[model samples]
Target: MRDATAEKTETALDAASLVTDMAKRARAAARVLASLNAEARTAALRAGAAAIRAAAPAILAANAIDMERGRSLGLTHALLDRLMLNEARIEGIAAGVEAVAGIADPVNTVAAEWERPNGLRIQQVRVPIGVIGIVYESRPNVTADAGALCVRSGNAVILRGGSEALNSSRAIHAAFVAGLASAGVPADAVQLVPVADRAAVGAMLTAQGLIDVIVPRGGKSLVARVQSDARVPVLAHLDGNNHVYVDGGADPEKALTIVRNAKLRRTGVCGAAETVLVDEAAKDQLAPLARMLLDAGCEVRGDAATQGVDPRVKPAAEADWDTEYLEPIVAMKLVHGVSDAIAHIERHGSHHTDAIVTEDAAAAEAFLSGVDSAIVALNASTQFADGGEFGFGAEIGIATGRLHARGPVGAEQLTTMKYLVRGTGQIRP
Candidate 1:
């Protein structure tokens, strides 16, 4: 008889082979997608959105199973929240897909044009980045967002969602397929890996020639693995240790409201503020802000000065400065001024998103310029650091790395620029 362990190993290898085959199919589909016009892509997205709305019952049923499994596995409340989806959330996801369809297609758009001295007309135009591999965790909405964005930008996508959301992702992917068929696009254009094996991720990471770019949308471990092991270029952020600084000139009411919403509105999201920096000059506001958080059922972790303001505040350790608490918890510290806040964020922040609540334009500008993050807000909630808020419809992820793309990875960012030079048989010197 064949060894059982060996058979399991063979099965895993087969799963890897399956993933590679999907990558190849996606590469071929990308050519077809690239030839499609903006109108055709929009039609496909709209079809997908309609399919999602029609399939809400089935999608929610799948989500319920995932939620039950998550609870049994002892997942955190935040993680479970990311996994669960209801009718309203599904509708929102569909709307986001429609919004992407409404946005102007980025492919073939002229970014720059000029005439050269050598009688040549040079124009820089955007083009699709070919096949993209999206490895995400928990959120099934990413299934719609990533597929729609890739289709809108004229690229094919291969999605590999976490096991926790496997059923919901498949349900959502079916909607995408229906949309593609409605628009006469290839079903392979947005293929999701069928197996939940870890080997599939490894195969995707190594499929350098088949996958043009890898975008990981998950926690630090997931992003770190993709960045470290993937042969393909990665566009991702390791963490969202975001911050909100209450400047001396900030309105107390604004600070309170922004902080409350930024931290507690939806704690599991990447835009949630993990740290609060209060200007020493605004010491009086500290107690009020801390009290508000306490009243809202948030656990406050603070330094000596902040802890002195409220007895409910727990003492913060050094590790809290660099942690991304995806929960109803926040770390607070008092800064000497804007400069101090900037220094602290520069040292501890994950360069995701940071905000300043200040009525003083100069102070706000200083904070905005000094802090090095993907998204910097002035008197705004850090939660506004989203692609939809930026009018991009939906985002694949927020790229914290400063390279080909930064901030939100939307349809426009999914494309690369190519030089379209026209001349009558002009040759290089």
Candidate 2:
């Protein structure tokens, strides 16, 4: 037994060493990626997509290994589901790469220009943010998404995916590197931290001086740890307890459709509707809407007033208002008007996405302007809160941070600006 334990320890040590080595190589490859032009970057992205398509069979085989392992380990059904990949998912990954190639490259653009009085001109130019470290869980698609975004934006990426998705990520990473090599870009432009050891996260969090930014794209516990412990700046939000408010003037039919789809389309996504709010004047319309949600197989958890209308609904505890169940469970409430809706959102929402269904232009405008979040919608399903849907191709994640970037963080949002000063011997006093 002691010998077996020691062997396990040695394996863990080897895995950690491999991860550190990969990080170093990625750091070096980033320098080469940072110098590529728009043409080279686009070519690389296109090649990457082709490579992914060619390797779809191998990728699926790798994903199958992950799925088998996850199932054998008795992981949650949701997690096991996330670990499985199919033909369409592989195609989706390739399409994501192609979409990114179509978007405008962000490097070397003059964002702003101004001339000083004393023969000095200044221009803010877009530039790469250097090495980016992304730590995420169970979605293999993130590997392709993060790699394509970073390369297109002229930044090198170090992706640390969940252990269950390791083989899948590695297969995808191999395709990306091959594309980079074929396109004359540095293959190291994208690297995966290759380890299952939990300590790998510690190494990434401490790579502050080397990695410019850290994007944690996973559950609340993962995001919280990154936010609290990382030496580098992190862009993350703990939850997406998104809401849909059906205002008084909202067309009841339209409102019901949107709300049902938002909550039931894909319950596991971050943007799935966790709460539904209705204006007091529309309180009478709640029964039909509740029936719609129920008919769609959603379990409604509602406050006292709402439960009175839908006795089948479970009584919602106070904490349900702010919970991100990430399931079929939805919390609902009734509000006085748009003001109350906004107030309720501000208090319980995760500041992710909120939709307002109303014909009143003034109320819609106020809600759009007043609600401070990454994405705000007018009479749309909150499930549309995705990078692909927004035409960004694929995103690192939706940023809730007020600084640098927000919303779907595509290639453009991945870059930062630097001032270029052209001066003719201008001297300061």
Candidate 3:
């Protein structure tokens, strides 16, 4: 028994060493990636898109295995939805890659240039952020999206997807590797940790010097663990308790449509609305909206005022206000006005995404300015918070943190700026 325990310890050490080595290779490859011309990087992404399309059959098969396992594990329907991938979804992922390839390369772009009085010229130019470690959950599409976004921005990435999607992520990552090779970029530039062990996640979190930044993409638990345990800087949001507010001036028709799409279009996505705040002045509209959601099969949990408006609404518990349902469930509340709505969101929101459905310019401006969130919308569905919807091709993830990056983190957000100074033999004295 002692020998067996020692063997297990040795295996754990081997895995840690392997992960460290992977980070080292990624750092080296990052330099190569950053030096590559924009055209070369774009070619790699385009090639990756093609490769993914070609491998759709294999990817789907791998997804099937994961789906079967998820079902047996009694994973929630929302999670199952995130885990399942069909041919159409594969095609969508490929299209996202292609879109990213078409975006303007951020590397070497001069953000600002200034000339000093003493004959020195200073330029702030964008550069890759070096190695980015993405630790994500069951969504295999994130593997392709994160890899493409990093390559597009000239940053090497190390992907650590959820264990449940290991087979699917591996299959998708193979396409990224093939594309990188075809474009003459180092395959190590975009690598997925082949092991699914939980210990590997710990190794990634502690790789401070090796990984320049860690981006965690998933539910609150995953992001919380990464944020709390990671020795490296993490770009992530702890929760996406997103909210949609219907103002007194909101058009009844538009509010109903936006509410339906925001909450029910795809509840599994992080941008999906979990809470609905209705202005007390517009309380009359609540019954119709609640009925619409219920008719569409969404379960509505509401405060007393909202429940009074609609008999179908279930009484909401206190915790519902702070919850990210990520399912076909929504919490509804009646706010005194725009100010109360803003206060409610600021108190319970995850600062991820929030929306205001109003035609009143003053109310819209107030809500937009008052709400402290990464992405705030006016007269639009909160689902528009996506990086793709923001026209960046694809996103690594939505960062609610106020550090280097925020909102939909695409290729541009994956870069950092450095000052480049040029002087012709100027002496300090």
The candidate that achieves the highest lDDT relative to the unseen native structure: 1
Position 273, candidate 1: lDDT? 99
- Can you write out model 2's per-residue Cα lDDT over 1-429, one digit (the tens) per residue? 469888767766665566567667777887788887898889999999999999999999999998988888897755666677999989989999999999888899999999998979999999988889999999999999999999989998888999989999999989877977898888777888867777778677877577788999988999999999898889777889999999998999899889998998888888899999999889877888887887778899887878888778889899999998878889988899999899999998889999999999999998999898899999999998888899888898998879988888889898999999999998998
Task: Sort every candidate by lDDT, greatest first.
Answer: 1, 3, 2
Q: Please write out the lDDT profile of model 1 over residues 1-429, one tens digit for every residue.
A: 999999888977887788789988998999999998998999989999999999999999999999999999999998998988999999999999999999999999999999988889999999999999999999999999999999999999999999999999999999778877887889999999987888789888988788999999998999999999999899999999999999999999999999999999999999999999999999999999999999999999999998998899999999999999999999999999999999999999999999999999899889989999999999889998789999999999999999999999999999999998899888887
Q: Residue by residue across 151-225, what tens digits does model 3's lDDT show?
A: 999999999999899999999999878977898899999999988887788888988799999999998888889
**What is residue 257's positional error in candidate 3, in angstroms?**
0.4
- List candidate 2 segments past 4 Å from native: 1-20
For all predicted structures, in order, the TM-scores are 0.98, 0.94, 0.98
TM-score between model 3 and native: 0.98
Candidate 3: worst-modelled 10 consecutive residues by lDDT: 7-16
Between the candidate structures 2 and 3, which one is better when assessed by TM-score? 3
Clashing pairs in 2: none
TM-score-superior candidate, 1 or 2: 1
Candidate 2 least-lDDT 10 residues: 11-20
Candidate 3 stretches greater than 4 Å from native: 3-12
Clashes of 1: 0
